[model samples]
Target: MPSVRVVSLVPSLTEAVAVTAPGTLVGATDWCTHPADLDAVRVGGTKNPDVPAIVALAPDLVIANEEENRAPDIAALRAAGVDVLVTEVRGLDQAFRELERVLDACGAERRPGWLVAAEAAWRNLGAPSAGATRHAGRLRAAVPIWRRPWMVLGRDTFAGDLLARLGVDNAYAGHAERYPRVPVEELRAAGLDLVVLPDEPYRFTRDDGPEAFPETLPAALVSGRHLTWYGPSLAEAPEVLGAALRAVYR
Candidate 1:
């Protein structure tokens, strides 16, 4: 019983809805590029969505996220009589709850199998030990999404939380800002044991980002979607991220 027509302003949510209930998505942002075979109309991007075009779709509902979509756009859509459900996902558990809520809103009664599988995968990781990262296997990590201004994961971020669950301590975990901007030289001198780079938000690659770090310091270049995306990708994220990190996080 999915909505007759729906639009997704966020890429992650787009993948979630598109996969969970395929034909419901009538329009999506240009950045929604998952499911390789998604057949939704393109309606601009996450930051600057085409409100008029979205309204033209006459969607019964529009899905969005607090951090990814602008407030003004949501308000405009609401004013136009479109039902917009905005999500706030700050952690792994929260992500699950939010995804379920979005699906329920879309008239989905049963949670998708992937959601259950993803939860089971992470739950199997168990709890972090009292002194898990004390010895040689201890890892002090810096995750940079964008390098132009040198922004690194800080404070209570989903990526940082996942890294911590994987036994990798975020170097800026105690920083006041969630995403702190630090100079490259400072990052290099921050005594980091490893730098976990993702191929998104800036697409850091082996040749492009690894060279920025010292030869002695190891860097794990992993998939940004797997590391940051919280959707159907979650089912494989634990294994995928673990394998990627293990490959280079030594």
Candidate 2:
């Protein structure tokens, strides 16, 4: 195994890679704040990494994500003859595989212990039986991702998928885009059971404008990254999110 210095371009991968191999991380983006000490690094955010600064870091490997990083930045890094590992994880299984790849890259052997723990945590959460008892009627929901045009988590998206796992059906499940916009009147007419306001991409809070949704729809502000972003952190989310769903549905 070779000793390799690494730069992380995506915030989530930055956090994951740092945990996987701490000392090997030479540069990380501004948004990668899980470890907190990562604030010392020069950053240009996830989509825009400083190429010259990255080159000056002289890292042996650069880790990035296909969804979070821009194609041009990856191309520039590759053209510079720098070794780059790009990950594309749409779900939990893909996330675990990505973590394994990072561990292998960092000269660390994959630990079955970690996988078993994660799997057990997921299985221990069980399924959402509360929905059957408490939610006999239509389970209407509004998962707002952004304001203005009012985008929401649609079918096949990570957030939508989590809602299904919790037995809370997405009201916008039929929308074409992963996140789609809905009119204010449509939200009112939908007769929602709950409206989930996420903390990111929109930053909806209790004091925020969600009150406009007619008092019938109960709203809860949740961690957007936890519900939407799948990675090593996902292994921990089922327990936390399951609790949230049980609280809301039950």
What is the Cα-based TM-score of model 2?
0.86
Best by TM-score: 1
The models' CA-based lDDT, in order, is: 0.86, 0.72
Model 1, position 244: C-alpha lDDT score: 76
- Minimum summed lDDT over a 10-residue window in model 1 is located at 126-135
lDDT of 1 by residue, 196-239 (tens): 99999889988988899899988888889988888999888888
C-alpha displacement of 186 in model 1, angstroms? 1.0
**What are the runs in model 2 whose C-alpha is more than 4 Å off?**
112-115, 129-133, 136-140
Candidate 1 segments exceeding 4 Å error:
126-137
